[model samples]
Structure formats: structure tokens, C-alpha cells
Target: MTGAVATAPAARTGRAPAPRPVSPTARQMRRAGWWFLAVPLALFVVFMLLPMGMAAVISLTDYAIIGDTAWVGWQNYARIWDDAFFWTALRNTARYTLMYVPLGLVVALGTALLLNRSYRAVRLFRTLFYIPVVSSTVATATIWYWLLNPQKGLLNVALGWFGIDGPRWLYDSQWAMTAIVLMSVWAGFGTNMIIFLGGLQGVPGDLYEAARLDGANVWQQFRYVTLPSLTRTTFLVSTLLIIGAFQVFDQAYVLTKGGPGNSTVTMVYYIYNKGFGSLEMGYASALSFVLFLIILVFSLINARLNRPGDGGRVRRRRVPAAVPSAVAAR
Candidate 1:
């Protein structure tokens, strides 16, 4: 009877009720969710992933963007090792990084420390300081080109007033790269200043008071308290500055066009000249990958060098605890 009750319930219900179909609203919602995800996913695949894949594939070949592509696996990479221009560009980039990173850090940290007060005009000063950051790179380059002008520029004119002869800046190979570095630091320090300011704010005020109570002087307090607190911020700013210094191209393009003697031909400028001016896309791609490896190695080294508790490369020694005065007397 129970089996019959279970078995015949559908039969007894006559023609078993048809399964309920999904509501139009529910189906529409499902479709909407899919469409919403589909657009960005499709864009990511098409724009980002596809281009990277194409670049990687092309880097192995000899494709000039106009003719047949020949697969010459690793040949482009081998050529990069032998390219003198590549080495020169790498050296210039390294020199720029060395000059820019330290100068940028010092200026940014100094400005941030100066503006870390509670005065009313601080905000106004910060806005003025950061105005250069917001200014277009091209505009800044053009203005610097005028300022560094060999004859009529304001910089040399100011130096002339002091009875000092200023060297030709952008026109001279020796000074062209230095001029670019100075201009970059001026236009770029504001962003790092803001970052350092944020880090300064995060430091505990109580630590300063404690240091003062310990009879620590201003320099001692700064060395022990402020610097220790700023390690992470310094690492962040240095990494960013290094990356930017390596990729510098726009200023070179606008001011010197990588001349007076390729003094300002950075890695990116080299890549750009190879890719566009020389029309060697495959070789250009290979150069780009080399630069990518160089950047990755430096970045990894920077990270390792600045990792927490590394003391920024100085090892901290554990001093033995002092013996009791009574024990010493015995």
C-alpha cells in the first residue's frame, strides 16, 4: 500500500504536473550579471593579455612591422648583448637613477619635515608645492628648456649676475643629463613629499616626547625616532623613483631628443627609437624584455635590501647586558 501510495501519487495526480520554468526576471538577471562580467573580461583579454602575448611571441622573431616575420629564436636577444647603444643607454639610465633617487629622497623628506607642522598656512604651501606635480610633463620640459637656455635663460642670467659663468645646459653633452635630472627632481619631488608627509603623520607623537625626556637632542631624536619610523616610506619612494628614472623618455624627447651625444638616451628612449624610428619592432620588443628583466632584478634587490629588520644594510649587533655594579666590585 505504501509503495503504491508513493508510486501512484504522480500517476494519481494525472499527467504529472509540468516542471515550472524560470521566471523572465530571474533569467534576465542572470543574463545581466553575465553581460556585466563579460565586458571587462573581454576587454582585459583583448587589450592587455593579447598585446603581451603578441609582444612575447614577436620578440623571438625578426619582424620589421612592414615585411615578413622570420622566427630567429633568441637571435634578437643575442644581438642586444652585443649592442653598444644598449650599454650606453643602460649606463645613462643607471647614472640618472643614482642622481635622481637620492636627491629626490632628500628633497622630499626635507620638504615633508618642514611642512609637518600644525600652522594655518601649511595647506597653502603644500598646494603650491604640489602644483608642479599636477603640471603636464611636456609643459614642465618646455619651461625647463627655456630656463636652461644657453644665453637668455633665467638660470644662466641669474648665475651671470653673481659673476659666475653657467655652462650651456641642454646643449652640452656633459651637462644635458644633469639638467634633465635636476628638472625631473624639481617637478617630481612634490608627490614624494606628500607621501613622506603621510608617513610623518603616522609616527607616534609620544615617541618624540619620550625622546625629549631622555635628553636626546634634535639630531639624536631624528636619527633614532624619525628615521626608524620612515623606513617603509623611504623604501616606497625610492622604488618609485628608481622605476621612473629608468623609464624617463618624455623629457629627453622634448628637451634634447636624446642628444647632444646620446647623453640622455635612457632605456625607454632607446626602446622608443628602436621601435618607432628604426621600425625594428621585433628587436625593440627584445630590448624591452631586457629592460624588463633589468628593472625586475633591481626592484628585487631593492626589496631585499630594504626588507624589515635589515636596518637598511647595516646589521644591528646585540650588545651584552651590563654586569651589576656589585658583581663588578667583587
Candidate 2:
């Protein structure tokens, strides 16, 4: 037994070494995680991050499609600052946003309110409104192009019935942006409508009942209850709409090519022409960065403005009417 004990100590002391310091399962899990992220990370690096970096580099150079390039050191941006066409496009985009965002909000909110009630065709109506949102922008543009055609178009034809000749829509510089705004609203409002519907449904039923009991009218209740409650959704929708409006491209591209005296020219279309048509890619990249900065700033502003109870970028809604009918009766 004493010999066995001494032998056991010797055996333990000489044990073949500690197990290899490794966790196969943990290693395998880490490998699997990388594998899982490989696709999106590769995609992001290639498509988004790489493009942005390349664009930034390009912006710094006086790069061109043909001939050896030189780094002009903000020359393109300096030129962009003085370019009248750039100003026109920027102005046009601002006007487009001013018109599009508010108009879109009104139509979407109104549609949502109309559809909020229980009705037989409510589901169908929801789907109907949603169809346009999913519809192809190119197809919508073509349809609109036809409808707004000066002579035989549906819009002008209808105007003739009322003894008023509608002005040439797409052909006229004055009416071109307006026409685009109308169609854009038609295409874009449905999504916001759905968002508003979800918000309205989420509003507390007891609040409505309380307002009713206090004798608040429909509009009053909407002002006091609905508008205030729907703030976050409205803010998001408005910001999105504003951003999209600033980046207006397809309609301007397809409809008028920014023509009829450059009326509907937008920043994106201008950049596109510079990059592809003129092959002034360096200048275009600069324009793109400027645009990106502008968008980021405004988005940040809108976000800041929409927060609760702070003197911020947006004006908060206030309504003063909430005493129940029962309370009044008493």
C-alpha cells in the first residue's frame, strides 16, 4: 500500500502534460459567426463603404474619364459654388421639398383618418392605397407623362370641360415641378398613411372615451388627442419625405430631363449628368459629398426638433379643449 501510494504520486507528477489549452466548440462558434457576417460585411465593404471612400478620393482629384488626372484641391467644389446651374438645381430641390413634404403629410394624414374607422371595404381600401406605394416609379412616371401631355392628355382634357385650358405641364418650366410634386405625393403618401393607421390604432381607447365623456368635438379630440399622440410617427414620416424630396431624381430624369429652361433640374440629376454625361466624375463626387452632408444635417435637425418638451427645431402641437360631456352636464 505504501509502495502503491508512492507510485501514484510519481505517476501524477509525470502525467502527460495539461490538456491542450483550446476550446474546439468555442473556436468553431467564432468561425461560424464570422462566416455568418461574411456576406453582409463583404457586401457593405464592397458596395457602401468602398464606394464612399472611392468617391471621397475622386472628389479630391480633378479626375476625368479621358486623359491623365490631377488633384485640383477643392477646385471642383469651388466651381460648384459659383455654378448657376448648381444653384438652380439646389433651389429647385428646396422648392420641391417645401411642396412635397407638407402636401404628402396632409394627404396621408387625411387618408389615414378616413380609413381609421371600421368599414366593410377597409381592408380592400388599405390594400388599394398601398398598391401605389409599391408601384414602380418608372411606370408611374410614364403614366404621369402621358396624363400630363398638353393636348390629348387626361388632365388637360378634364380642364377643357371646365372651360379652362390647362397650361402645358411637363413642357412648361413653371408647371413641370408642380406636376412632379402631385404624382410624387400620389406615389408616396400610402406608406405614411399605413404608418399613421398603425399609430391611430395604437392610441388608447379610454382616451377617446374620456374625451367623448368630456364633450369634446371630433376635431377638438383629434387636435388634443390624435395629433399629440401621433407626433413621433409624423416626425419620422416628415423627415423621410423631406429627405426623399431633396433627392428627387427619377421623375426629374424621366419626365423633363431638367428642361423647359431648366425648371425642374435637381441636385442628383445634375451630379448624374456630370458623372456620366460629361465624365467629370471628380466634380460629381464632390457634389455627392456636399449633398450627403446636407441630408445628414437636416435629418439630424428633424430628429432633434421632434423630441418631447424641448425648445427644439419643430413646433409642438397644443390643443385646449378637454372637458367631458358628462362633466359638463353635471
Location of the lowest summed lDDT over 10 successive residues in candidate 1: 319-328
lDDT of 2 by residue, 54-136 (tens): 99999989788898899888888898889988998899998898899889999999999999989889989999999988999
* Candidate 1 C-alpha lDDT tens digits along 220-311: 56766678778888889989988888888888899999999989899999999999999999999999888888888888888877775544
What are the lDDT figures for the candidates, one per model? 0.87, 0.85
Error in Å for residue 217 of model 2: 0.7
Candidate 2: misplaced stretches above 4 Å?
Answer: 1-41, 308-330
TM-score of 2: 0.82
* Cα RMSDs, all models: 9.5, 8.3
Clash count, one per candidate = 0, 7
